[model samples]
Target: LEKAGIEIDRKVLADIASADPTAFKAIADKARAALA
Candidate 1:
């Protein structure tokens, strides 16, 4: 994400990645939107 210039809390992201894939996708979509 850093390479994309999006900064998120690592632990929170990890939790989302492991426990809440829906949220992880949401976050990734949001980040992609931000980049666009």
Candidate 2:
């Protein structure tokens, strides 16, 4: 997100992501697409 000029709490995001890896990948892909 930083590369995309988006600011978010990495630690908080990491915590939330660790809860569900599958969801994390999906969300990550979406974020990448949006950033792209």
TM-score of each: 0.69, 0.50
Candidate 2: residue 3 Cα off by (Å): 11
Tens-digit lDDT track for model 2 on 1-36? 665454658886697688878866776776797777
Whole-model Cα lDDT of every candidate shown, in order: 0.83, 0.71
Q: Give one digit per residue, the lDDT tens place, for model 1 in 1-36.
A: 665676788987998899989989988987887778
Superposed on all Cα atoms, model 1 deviates from the true structure by an RMSD in Å of 2.9
Best by lDDT: 1
Give candidate 2 misplaced runs (Cα > 4 Å).
1-12
Which pairs of residues clash in candidate 1, taking residues 3 or more apart in a chain or in different chains?
none
Cand. 1 Cα-lDDT: 0.83
